[model samples]
Target chain A: MIVDSNLSFLQYCSNDELKTLCDTLTHDNKGEVRLSEQLTDNDVYLRCYPDNMKGMWQEIAAELQRFGGNTFANIFRGGVGASYESILRDVCKKMKVRIPSCSTVEEIEIALLTKYCEETIGSMDIDLLHELSVEIGIKPQSYNKQIVAAAILVALRRGGGKVLAPVIYYIGSNISRILIGRGVYLATAGVLGRAAAALAGPIGWALTAGWLAFDIASPAYRVTVPAVIQVACMRLKHNSHFLTAQCV
Target chain B: MHPADAKAILALKKIPGFNYLVRKYMEYGGESLYRGQNLANHVKVYEDNFPALYRVFKETVTALGIDEPELYVYNDPYINAYTYGETRTFIAISSGAVETLSPDELKGVLAHECGHIVCHHTFYNTLLYSLVELADSFKGIPYMLFGPLVLALQYWSRRSELSADRCATSIVGAQAYQKVLAKLASGMKSFKPNGKELLNQAYEYHDIIEGSLWGKIQQNCQVAFQSHPQLCERAYEVDRWSKSCRYRQSRIRVC
Candidate 1:
């Protein structure tokens, strides 16, 4: 029985029960979960988890709730880690919502949680949401936060739960490492996106005229800097969402 | 040094009249012209002026066990740095680079320039720099004549950049060096980066380069005239070297 120290509800289970629960978690309701053979030890989840995990995590969380583990059961379906309060604070900050300094952590958490759920996308910071939307391949017709958020949610459903890993990564959210570890989503994004990403644009060339404007000292950088910068953009684009499969 | 870079240097050596061209370029005071031009145009950094940047440059040079070269900052909005001169080598950074890079990233840039110096690349690099200027200025007849030489120099120059990146990575640690690379790729406004993400991207790029014939042709044609390797390839090379026995063994002894 491999117990994850992070999930506190494991403490409620007796030794025998823990063994059974562990078996249940690993096996799902089916037989042994067939993980991708290519998955390293770091990624212990099922390979078919894009569909399976969503349904299965809910079932397990419900079972745990019946076992009197309310806290673990109420954990966000987004698979955010134990540092939910900090991540919520980050989401609030990025969304530019003010948190009262006097408010307790729990109060602030609940307030922000309500705000995150109840507020219209229009009330959210347009720039942050737009930036995040573009990053995850959501192209809503309008900049309304709700519309954009809805688009992202729809994309998440269609693409699988891991589709928003980049957005979470960008916003500094403590999304569980388990989500990031499974990289097949981007790997399967297709050759065209990969090709466009691998061959970065001439960002360096556009900056060159400004770089060489002075023209007084023909520093050897006239040879290297813009070219190096060009290469850097290539690396950056190759790594960023540009290469990821269009989840939307 | 990367095997590709070593091979490129050998190919450049094999080019006809390559040595003669470098000799003639050097004999005509090609290096001296830049010293005067830079002294007049760029701000020289010493103990007093831009002391912080000078300290980083000095420290980087010392770490690499190389002679201290004069440091200069040229006014420019684009982030860039380069090593120039022969008998008395010099390294120059753009004002934009100073404004943008963090202290450690600046160290990585300086270390890269210092690496070029340590590797005895400045003299030939100066000739290539001059040839590019000459070709740009006289695009008709002289450009036609210098085409082969320029292509070969560019080829070697790209590989040399990989070697220099390795030197910087070894000195500043791969993480900071990668940040510098990422910053150079993007601009200051979008400076945030995860090193592993960048490496993963680089790996994807390498896959394209290896797996697709069209990708190889496209990349070769794109970089044919440029004086640096594709950034993703450089990042990929640097990341791999950072994890290699050579880098590990060196660090162990240094520690």
Candidate 2:
């Protein structure tokens, strides 16, 4: 007659009833549960439960985040923090939830706690609880092979953003710089042609002469053309936007 | 002898799931000295690797109601942690465990192990360890595959996690323990976890957790393959417990 009095969930077991339940559980042949890993550490539950409850587990996340985490630095230093048992007992006490007796630590009180959270807190508790349920062993999860697949996808995609991006930026900036330099080159050539025209005294003949000599060989042309070309090159060298388009 | 009904194991072992693996992995003799030889290589190495963990160990004994004991350590990738010894209780920490948890999360880990200390869980743990080994050694193959044997061990393991979670909540705030749990849940699932999503997962899985055999089975299956509760599961439960009315009834349950 093993019966839980306060939890409100009841089951009456006769010898045969007990035998059937025991046999079914022991030899269920359920490959779902792993053989090696121990299940002793899973005894967690909602503080107290009600048959029907209101709010879904909305604040669960906030609760987890409340205490936050310590830096790696802190743990190595062996600074202060309370023990797990004390934490469990204290939390239940503070929340005004019933603390289980020593007898209960080895019982199904854990499930009751989880149920309470789900029924009362609803999706939030479930969502929050999901974070606690490990993928292996007994929780209901259809082990997606794709997590590995996704990880593979992510791994394959690594460094693409950084590596390919810069190459494109360099090329595009140069291209844009060169495109913009066309106007400057043409204007300078015209100016040289006009000046040559004045020096040679004939408009058409002087223009041809300037085109052949000053515009082609003069220091201004040498300096300006190369500088203009370099401005395009500099834009190519420094401009992030042009670099961005190429990478994509 | 009833596989599920180990009076000694239930009374003695501190962390819940200890019996199952200790029983299963009983290739070595059941001598405390067997673990003793492993101790120098085991516990001390972790102490050197994680200096802060050693400090936590010292502080736990100094804590009220605690009597110090010798420490032990083992090498395993699983996330199991515990405390044991007769009069001098010291905590055993694993390298895999050290690598997996954050410092605060690690603090929760240590504190939970400490819970076994003051509660006299180590003595029970020693007792249960023998009981489980006896059942397995005497009963042989059928019992090994039997569900009752599996269930008891599973139940114990899950309970141990809760005890530890309580330990953490007591030392820090329940919030910190929850945060650590949430992280464990997330880490087990997708290796990469956004903090909020992990919290959300902890809440989502809250429904199936139960204290009964079926619930234990579900919980067991949930954690059988895992070394610890899913981070979200740990976090969410911590949150629920911290804010829980049942939890509040216990004095100093939260920091």
Candidate 3:
């Protein structure tokens, strides 16, 4: 059985195009039926000459061109049957599914499915499960469990992992803020160093040097020292005012 | 440090995975690669090459009490200046900026870039710039995944500008700092900006941004992807600081 796990190319392909390709690949020709596992678990193979492999690739590329145009089919024009081999490798890594180098496409698919299903089920949020159940028109009280189970099975079969949209958004937004925040602290340190140097001469210089050293050496000090200095300087000013009043 | 920067830092520390992100950024070799590319494209400015600019740069660094960084001048048409590099920091100024700005204004620009070094924004800025470039290529990857990271970086980048503006104002006077920003906005083609008018424009801009929600939103959107605030906002910040006791006290008599 020669299975092409070039299914990843279908991500860029439309559903109607995928159906046509699947139908053409699976269609019986002279008792040689090449079935897609996505459509069926039926074990079948195309009986053809080794030299005919190139012809088969040309056929597939021609079929792909109907949907994806020349650029899409151009990727496989080099007679590389495994057009999605790199994408498969990435998916395997992401899903933590291990398949031996010599393993069949069926073996890779099964391993990927098993791992993906396990992860999706294990990490499925209760709210999401409930939402999925409701969205599928299942009664939340009676058919909730069945709906969730069916959805998980479908998701596994469809090769869809848990959507990490929220997590991605949070990280993206916060990372920008964090970087900005870091810049702010750094700027604050510079301001403090300048202000201290101006106000107290040698003592101020000593304080500024200490702050800079700490800021350079430790990220924590960089964050803390600015606020501390701001408050301390304000207090010191207040105290000086009090001292001046007493002298008068 | 500016009060705003202190506030921003405090807000940033609360974010989860920030330390991890910083660690990953530090570990990335993209910055070094970028520096290598820059070294090839730009001319390194030294005492022998650009004596005046180099001297001014040195004076700013000395005044700020920071280690001297390499300076590069690139023949770009855009009137801008930036600093990059991590292990060995470098400041680059566009020829447009030098040609357009007066010596005093150029001093402010150099001082602003130096401020980034003093504030330790150099390394992170390089990392952020690299990440943004990467994000540009990988469009399928949701911005939510790395978008906020870039946004946060832009946020920091913008705030750092404010800090840098303050640094510039302290080194050169408020007038030169304001002129640099005005010149950056309206170029030196035909209009020589009056210092008082530019200052008033900054104040008017401040009022617009502060007075209405629509103005505030416009301001935010305007600076969303920019590394620096609007020239008016920056000019306003510098002008405001110039009048403050802290600015007066910290203002250095530069050579």
Model 2 lDDT tens row, B138-255: 8755446544544454455445555566656766566556655555554452354333465576555555554356865776576663324566655655655566544464434332
CAPRI grade, predicted model 1: incorrect
Task: Name model 1 segments beyond 4 Å from true.
Answer: A1-248, B253-255
- DockQ, every prediction: 0.01, 0.10, 0.01
lDDT of 3 by residue, B223-249 (tens): 898777777777767766776545656
Shift in Å, residue B209, candidate 1: 2.8
Point to the candidate with the largest lDDT: 1
Candidate 3 lDDT at A147 equals: 59
- What's the ranking of the predictions by TM-score, best on top? 3, 1, 2
Assess every candidate by TM-score.
Answer: 0.50, 0.37, 0.50
Per-residue lDDT over A1-248 for candidate 3, one digit per residue giving the tens place of the 0 to 100 score: 11333432333333333333333333221112222111111111121111123223434433322222233444455423223343344445543467788865444545553443344333444554465445433345544555565664554445422222111112212112222233333435466534533544432233233333323333222222232222222232333455678999
Please give, for residues A43-146, the per-residue lDDT of candidate 2 as tens digits.
Answer: 22232222111121112111111112122533453532222233334333433446456633212223222222222212222332233232211242534433
Q: Give me the displacement of residue B117 in model 1, in angstroms.
A: 0.9
Candidate 1 per-residue lDDT, tens place, A1-248, comes to 11222233333323332323323322211122212111111122222123233223333333332222223533543322223233334444544557886764434433433332223222335565676678777775896767776776566545532453443343323111111211222323445434433332232121122223312232222212222222222222233444474653
Clashes of 3: 14
**Which structure is stronger by lDDT: 1 or 2?**
1
**Runs of candidate 2 exceeding 4 Å displacement:** A1-248, B1-34, B45-50, B72-79, B85-88, B124-150, B186-199, B206-233, B244-255
Candidate 3 interface RMSD (Å)? 35.4
